[model samples]
Target: MVAGATSQASAALRTYPIAPGVSVNVRSGPGTHFSIVRTLVAGASVPIYCQCPGETVSGTYGTTNLWDNIANGQFVSDAYVHTGSDGYVAPQCS
Candidate 1:
């Protein structure tokens, strides 16, 4: 499990890192900041249960994508999903 956060399975998670070099962003308030999750890299798949579609959006509901919190084996959004030939997280787990 990740440090500061826990698995968001309880939440309606989404998929992220659908590709590489995409760099899924960890924002300070759902959007903006563009701070990396630190745990995820290109290809790292995460389940986004709580999504905040856009940075300017006011609420988390009515979000388009399935957003996951990669604090514990999770992912935020596909914004950083890999765009490589394979499109998957590297050094995969078991």
Candidate 2:
């Protein structure tokens, strides 16, 4: 390999896949009560910057209270993300 390629590969690995066939809502906060900031296209993959506890949700994965912070002010239910962990996959959001 090439320089920095390993890091790039590791970064790619950090991204988790969204649930199949669903256009998931990206909320401003970690709960359904939060306003919708945007919606993700089906088959979207997102890199989780952090995670936080919020309202529990059930989706293609399983029910959980953990929310994955994909970007600043953007969060999605962990139940919709395939992170291969039932718990926190990134640092806790502050």
Candidate 3:
């Protein structure tokens, strides 16, 4: 069975890349200082369970205070992610 399969299935919020051809780093935390857990390809869609404020990042879309929770303990800067809004589109991470 896949890890976090139930949670993944239940996640309704999705975010896409804001910049074309540029892969975004998925980190253990919400900042660039954190260790990179993986990389999400540009134009790839990721399920965002929630958001939280972290290191500010400026990207092609704009600056944002939100970081996307793409998986269990996995975060990516919201600045590079197009969530269809500038504000929090999902619940705040706990």
Candidate 4:
């Protein structure tokens, strides 16, 4: 029998799935309190570099205190993202 290799390295990022037909606002910071940087189209998949506790946001999925860092100085509320889990899947943003 051939042996399969296993890797222990953590993923550098995670995919944040957005619901169909729902546009999401991308922010300069982690919450609505921050200015809007841009908007993500429906069915968009973004790579979450990290996460952090931010202002609570309510969306189609529900309410959450987590915000996902999608790019350099960009963040989006986790309440609108289907992360396939109920908890933090990546490292917290510093």
Candidate 5:
């Protein structure tokens, strides 16, 4: 009965619902160094096309904050977002 509810979807499009109490940050870039567009409340959802390139954590570099990819993280500010799984900023993304 409604198995894989989160994985189920219309046609071939599989939608991943926001995890319980999960927060997806809306960073400017793939990684840190970008400003936040805004914060989406829990239960809010967006169509995710591409995901931030997963990074390897290193003590010298820092924790694996994918948002750090913003502006190359060399000459730009980083934006951190904390929202429920389905929540995220989208103004700049639009």
Candidate 6:
């Protein structure tokens, strides 16, 4: 029962698609000045755990200062993610 509940909750988390044909850089922090921790695979979809203001970037989605937190210490520019919204899609990072 507990496992089923956990699965349901995990499944409820929404994943947003990355820009097609682009392998986005995952940064340790919300800005480009932060070290690149990894590169997302092309066509990857990510669950935004939170969001925060960051360096303004221009990408397939246009320019924005929003950064999506996909994991602890892992962030990607929202400009490269297609969240279908021009604004915040998740809670702001604390």
Is candidate 1 or 4 superior in TM-score? 4
Q: Cα lDDT of model 3 overall?
A: 0.81
For residues 1-94, what per-residue lDDT tens digits would candidate 6 score against the true structure? Answer: 5754666457538899999999999999989999999999889999998899989999999999999999989999999999999899888899
lDDT of 2 at 89: 74
In the range 1-94, model 2's lDDT, one tens digit per residue, is 7975677447635788899999999999999999999999999999998899999998999989999999889999999999998988787998
**Residue 16 alpha-carbon offset, candidate 3, angstroms:** 3.6
Lowest lDDT block of 10, candidate 4: 1-10
Rank by lDDT, highest first. 6, 2, 4, 3, 1, 5
Return the TM-score for candidate 5, rounded to 2 decimals: 0.37
Q: Which stretches of candidate 4 lie over 4 Å from their true place?
A: 1-10
Q: Pick the candidate with the highest lDDT.
A: 6
User: How many clashing pairs does model 3 include?
Assistant: 0
Whichever of 3 and 5 has more lDDT, that candidate is 3
State the C-alpha lDDT per candidate.
0.40, 0.91, 0.81, 0.84, 0.34, 0.92
Candidate 5 stretches greater than 4 Å from native? 1-15, 54-94
Instruction: Give per-residue lDDT, candidate 3, residue 94.
Output: 88
Model 1: runs farther than 4 Å from truth?
Answer: 1-16, 34-39, 56-78, 81-94
- Per-residue error (Å), model 4, residue 71: 0.3
Least lDDT summed over 10 consecutive residues: which range in candidate 1?
57-66
Cα error, candidate 4, residue 54 (Å):
0.7
Checking candidate 3 for backbone clashes, the offending pairs are none
Per-candidate clashes come to 23, 0, 0, 0, 14, 0
lDDT of 5 at 29: 54
**lDDT by residue for model 4 over 25-67, one digit each (tens)?**
9999988989999999999989888899999988877888899
What's the CA RMSD for each of the models? 11.8, 2.6, 5.6, 3.1, 10.2, 3.3
Between candidates 1 and 5, which one is better according to TM-score?
1
Q: Candidate 6, clashing residue pairs?
A: none
TM-score of each: 0.38, 0.87, 0.80, 0.84, 0.37, 0.87
Task: State the lDDT of candidate 3 residue by residue for 13-89, as single tens digits.
Answer: 44555467779999999888999999888778777788899998888778875789889989988887777888887
